[model samples]
Target: VLVCLILRLSGNVGAAPESALITSLPGFSGAFPSKHYSGYVTIDGKPSPKNLFYYFVSSERNPQLDPVVLWLNGGPGCSSFDGFVYEHGPFNFEVGNSTGTLPVLHLNPYSWSKVSSVIYLDSPAGVGFSYSENTSNYVNGDFQTASDTHTFLLKWFELFPEFVANPFYIAGESYAGIYVPTLASDVALGTKTGAKPIINFKGYMVGNGVSDPKFDGNALVPFAHGMALISDSMFEEAEAACNGNYHEPKDQKCSNILDEIDEALSGLNIYDILEPCFYGSAAKDDERKNTSSLPLSFKQLGATDKPFPVRKRIFGRAWPFHAPVRDGIVPSWPELVKRSGLSVPCMDNTLATIWLNNEAVRKAIHASPEAGEWTLCIDIAYTHDAGSMIKYHLNLTAQGYRALIF
Candidate 1:
């Protein structure tokens, strides 16, 4: 979501870290309109370090004055680059003829960076290019993720203090529905508690976010019924069986009805119901084969848990979607995959997987060679400690922090 560019001249106090500056990108030959910087910010140093990676694109309109927005993509385990590559990032990628080739990049006319500088971050250790020397840090939840991201912001500001006074905003889609508001609350608290490099925290935005388990879980039936994806009789039966509480069905009959409804809607694209499902093709076999070492969420979301040629499955089964646990941890991605053994029948991440894994691309972006493979989503033993984000939203909004839900 690219908003209208707002100008606000502010004083810059420190020099931007030169080492983090991106001189060039591998696939795109055109000159960048504004400065770009990327590198790791050590969230926890030494003995067992936790390093978070970020790619910062300065606002083309005014790097010095435009708002700085931190963008996140939610899977509890997903990468923000999902936004950077496919959504509102500055570049639009053209998939190569073969999966092994680097994607061609062109300037995106509707890039959010046109209006504001955007930081595409990989948060929580073990996601995307972010990593931890000690594997134990990989098991984290909402609180630690928010806290680490806040720390990233503080250290990031220290490296590029010029933007410290700029009006700062947080934006994300999907599961970031949880990430944005919670992180906003933390940033607001940081400013009030006299945290260093006081950011001019402004507001936040969430797109198709998940806030409460009860509300989110119950939304599917009505939404499906309204969309005409399910039958009148089926909807009536589900309503009667579940007593309008889809999140927690009282009996096996309701659960069975719900399963029937899922079967009815299974053929449609969960992300975009209008789109036809993509049955696996020979060209995609290579991409599918590359999944063994990749994160389970990507495979599960793509619905590739079992062997190829599986039916297109809905995202409802994936994490962040399974968000209404209210308490306890969502099953790890591999566990979910093992149980379902289904593939995402429509979604294809071939380009992102290929382009990102390229040695040239990694080097160009300042990603460590040792960072291993890149994955859109990773497997994390995440505990839903934040429970319902309703309180966080109410708290932040009450404090005058603007919030947008789309």
Candidate 2:
């Protein structure tokens, strides 16, 4: 079969077929079966448009009739490329020699594209390649972000109307626990009100998400004890002191016990409890040398020494969003968790980051020349005004929408 990569459209700039379609990739050896499209969808149209960037990969087996799943990476500031490149995209970037060179791309055997079409979106105006000419749009809060995403989907369907009838499912990880449901609810409302470009709204899934802050807190200390990261006596003390309310312990001793729990699990990769933290591995040898249980310090991980050969931090105006110091039970306390869009302990994005930064790769994917360097996450200016999304979940179920929380 004939193959094409970047399809630079020349017709109506607003037309779907012309505007955001990608025809070529930077490092693929030959044209493969699956089709790829990458481009921007303007959420705010015309004068001062707010553009949301997206990467669309169709299923390998059947393009015309497959479930169209939308994937969003959490952090409220993290790029969906985390899902696209590392977790479930068509290719994985191969970081070579630890040199900041153009990383190579290799086909991913378990890419979700094998069964369903996927749209990986970088949202909220300031995240990833998506941006707003009006700086005021950057600091928008939770409901606003969800509203913008709903607008994105409606506009997107207008461009590719074929999948309007396909099984549509929205899925996200981490904080997207809030995003997915909020957006899904919007879609459900649109369906109910007979919105344009009719969407066949279905269920959604949230993996390792932050559903309820209170629920999230209830399990941490118990989970730590179960994992053998803490002693039984410590667990008993925490349970008795906190009276099962770890979020806001009733007494000072309970609060102290919770602090003790934090100390016990101090530097372990909070993302994956079992994995060795690569943070302290300053040099190539350092990464391999300190594989034991001891929590490696930032200095011992060679932080002050200009760092290890792999997993370099892409710090700048782009990609270094952080949780607030007073963040709720889930993100706060675990020191390095979600800082600057940092990947959980073992995720390696060196290849993806390098490849995406390459000039040719950027042009092939139709990246905006003006948008700054590609980073893991953006230092997004967002406010969490929604507090809890339990109401959104209840609302979805009330509207007959199915849901999955993992």
Using TM-score as the measure, the top candidate is 1
lDDT of 1 by residue, 10-124 (tens): 2444588888888888889999989999999997744487989999999999887789999998877777888888778898887566646788888999999999999999977
When superposed on Cα atoms, how far off is each prediction in RMSD? 6.4, 7.6
**Stretches of model 1 off by over 4 angstroms after superposition:** 1-11, 45-47, 277-339
Compute each candidate's TM-score over C-alphas.
0.85, 0.80
For residue 35, model 1's alpha carbon misses the true position, in angstroms, by 1.0
Best by lDDT: 1
Candidate 2 lDDT tens digits, 66-100: 78999998876778887887677898566455556
Q: List the residue pairs that clash in candidate 2.
A: 5-23, 5-24, 6-23, 6-24, 7-23, 280-301, 282-308, 319-377, 320-340
Q: Report how far off residue 292 is in candidate 2 (Å).
A: 11
Please, what is the whole-model Cα lDDT of each candidate in the order they appear?
0.76, 0.69
